[model samples]
Target chain A: MKADNAAIVRFENLTLGYNHHPAVHHLHGEVAPGTLLAIVGPNGAGKSTLLKGIAGELRPFQGTIHLHGVRKENIAYLTQQSTLDNTFPIVVQDFVAMGLWRHFGAFRRFDATAERRIAESLAAVGLTGLENRPIGQLSGGQLQRARFAHVMLQDSPLVLLDEPYSAIDANTVHDLAGLVRRWNTEGRTVISVLHDLEHVRSEYPETLLLAREVIARGPTEAVLTAENLKRARQLAEEQGELVGAPVCAADEDAEQAIHAHLGHKHG
Target chain B: MSLVDTLASVPVLSPFIEFAFMRRALAGCLALSLGATPIGVFLMLRRMSLAGDAISHAILPGAAIGYLLAGLSLPAMTIGGLVAGVAVALLAGGVARNSVIKEDASLATFYLISLSAGVLIISMRGSSVDLLHILFGSVLALDDTALLLLAAFASLSIVAIAAGLRLIVLECCDPAYLARISHLGAVAHYGFMALVVLNLIGGFHALGTLMAVGIMILPSAAARFWVQTIAPLILVAIALAFAGSVVGLLLSYYVDLPAGPAIVLTLGGLYLLSMIVGPLGPLVSRRRPRWHFTR
Candidate 1:
């Protein structure tokens, strides 16, 4: 596995599936260093699944996922939903401390240095003073911040987020984007699955439109053209993807039938 | 009245209270309570309450076999129970991880199988009503050696849990992050579950298997209504357990009730009161949302 330059992630001919039934077929992409790539597509277009495959939560049936020239344990990941048990009686500080668990030996205690690092991470995520508070008591936005704080504590060079903004308030969405911007500025590469097209257009310079395949990838302004979006919708429909049907419906219902010929042909 | 005056008011209580047997029982109860508090905290947070109940029932077969093998020596019986408890916990966890079955169903299946197997083992050994001790407990009959051993094990359980606090909490709440980073989730899950089984084993002599498991968990569940943070939750649970132990011991002495039942009953009362007065319970925290800081 030769290190792929400074690229944070390199996926070559990636095919992911369950029990040999293909979900994502022959997908390929590379995230260069310091690039924030927004992965966008209709739901079930394998956006989250692609992220999962890269996160190592789900193994790829084909192709290689290389991170920083090595296997992908070097990356940090955030899931679409918080997926945390809110009833757990843990403080925010304790939750953040989890990022350092991998650094300590089996019998080692958290040293003063590690504690200081944890404090720095919490502060970075704007959660400094609230570290001692229980995680169960966090509001929705606060919970998202805590999850981000956990990733920051990991201090990795590559960060993967699978829809970190769903159901979050507008201010939280802005803060999350700012956090991602800051991480990118610090030379960390970010690949996020985002549903919001507006956020993708404004915040991300690069975008990968997925529909169980690499529908489009490159600069967001160039690749997210009306023609490409129409093609993506048609491809998603052709695959019988659940999330794609609505977008196709919206296209047919909302738009002035610009792609009516192609939509009917695909349908 | 002062605590000393209360002690003095009952002259007959002096011997029982000061005697080695009673002292051992009290000490054993205290240690078991501490050891099991973390387990209860994890169980409730993970939404695995029924899992605890299942584990409690499943250890019966192991305890019975231990009794038969060592003729009821505390260590042998405890070791057997520990093995059984861990086996059940792992099997349940494995089934939940591998299959589509919900965790509750897996726990129930294991609970039923192991409990029936335990009964069968006892019957095969020609043991009759003696099995009641396993169900209700032998806390009052704790000898000095068993008490000391329990104390040691309890201390170890506490220290181990404290050292792994970050990983344990992470595994319980945000396991996705842990799994993403490394093998921390696997290690933490198995390690903490092992401790749970060990705690139940250590507690068998103090409360009998059934009540032992109940006392380990129920107090922590009650304490949940009062606190928002994990540290505070554990502290509140320890305090509740200590209070329950003292009151149960005293009540058993004065009322001529069995100590195990009395302690469980006292804990049950505390839970009911907390449900009425503490937050998130039926009666309290209903009118207002308590504002807790989030990191």
Candidate 2:
């Protein structure tokens, strides 16, 4: 039970899970300010769940996740792009504008200054002209960029991203990774759950390799050793993690329900 | 006659002008469309359209209890419906989140129980006509109390929605992200759903429970085919609903049909039409493309 006063994020004996089945087990660690860390592990390594814990989406079943000097509102968290309903009738501009929650909040005048910030965010992500296009109309890569632009508006001291580049193209991943690096330079702590070892080794200086529990936590070179990754996979298989909760939309019957209710003959 | 005078003389416009009931029905439906259409869009985006419907059905038992105690009193029934709707919604949501059953299944279960209990209660005490009025509504016979209730609900709904507009939208688009940023989504989520239930209760008096959910849903479904942004989508949905109400009311006046179903069917017709011919429809967007982009 060591509490690090200097650490931006400290987890002590933390257990997070669904239905009391701990996805992340007794995780104890401290993330220093401005650390660009990648959490890497096997498929069910509790990576996303761990990030969820830090983002305050889940309360720890056992221990504590202490954030020193961080207001809960200033943390920007992005889950899988799949969890986002792109088909929502929101333009890229307004979609990105939501990130300004830390700024304007629910109902504030989005005057010229806020509009400028939105423009700046889109430009940062190279989505200048596509601002008016519906988010549903954007390509996968374009959507990712739009989400990143959203994070830009958040302007938070800490950013937690889950599987940010899982389905992205190599070039887009690189471009987005550059944005992560930019945030790092701006003294923002970015903890991302990523699978690409090469990208992690290249872009992230810190790594936390996990398998329902801490496998390794140190520099990328030390934590991502072949031995540790193998152990993570083995630990994951042996423990047999509980199924993760359904992401944002718990939609099992959406497609059929909509068609049936609308009396769509074309379903 | 002047152009304005000539337009007022149209056969469709005459019924509304000639009858006070028609005017009240038109006002009530328009006000309902203004508030509920936007809520419908949110429900669809959240993939909770059926959940909204379930809440509507869930309100019946509570309203029936009110009816049993007070004999068709407006305030009593309104409070009863609100309590029942919020309770059922919370219970279904809790069970789904905690248990193995999905939300849709849990809601369906509760709605069936609630609806059957409601019907049984009404049949036990009230006459068959009372049951019919509760189920099918009396749009052509709205008293001052129902009209006032509908107007107040509409105004309150508009202000409440505007106050929580950003939270509701962000939550629908990305709930997990919104959760991380603010817990306002939790508040907005329930608040918006309560408004959905509240709007349905208001609409049930004018359009009946059977058709109340239809006005909230069908126009939004139709609007989805044509618009690709929230503001315009809501506008289109409201326009579609208003058009349907006017036409449906006239159709009922001339041909003598149930006003509630007639209005909903007209909305259904509009929905079908949009699917076929809207600019973003399968027929149009596939062939002509709304926007062109390049690498």
Fnat per candidate, as a fraction, reads: 0.76, 0.94
Model 2 per-residue lDDT at B60: 84
Q: Lowest lDDT 10-mer window, candidate 1 chain A?
A: A244-253
Top of the candidates by DockQ:
2
- Writing each residue's lDDT as its tens digit, candidate 1 over A150-259 gives 78877677788988988888887888789899898887778999988888999999999887778889999987899888988987777674432121233322243336
* Tens-digit lDDT string for candidate 2 (B193-266): 78888898898888776667888889999998988888888889889988998889988988999888888899
Off by over 4 Å in 1: A1-6, A69-71, A100-129, A242-267, B1-7, B10-18, B126-129, B289-295
Report the lDDT tens digits of candidate 2 across residue range A112-199. 9999999999998889999899898899999999999998898888888989997789888888899999999888889999988998
Look at candidate 1 and tell me the lDDT of residue A218: 95
Candidate 2 backbone collisions, by pair: none
- Alpha-carbon RMSD, each predicted model: 8.2, 9.8
Model 2 spans with C-alpha error above 4 angstroms: A1-5, A14-27, A61-63, A211-216, A222-267, B1-9, B289-295
Please report, as a residue range, the 10-residue window in candidate 1 chain B with the lowest summed lDDT. B286-295
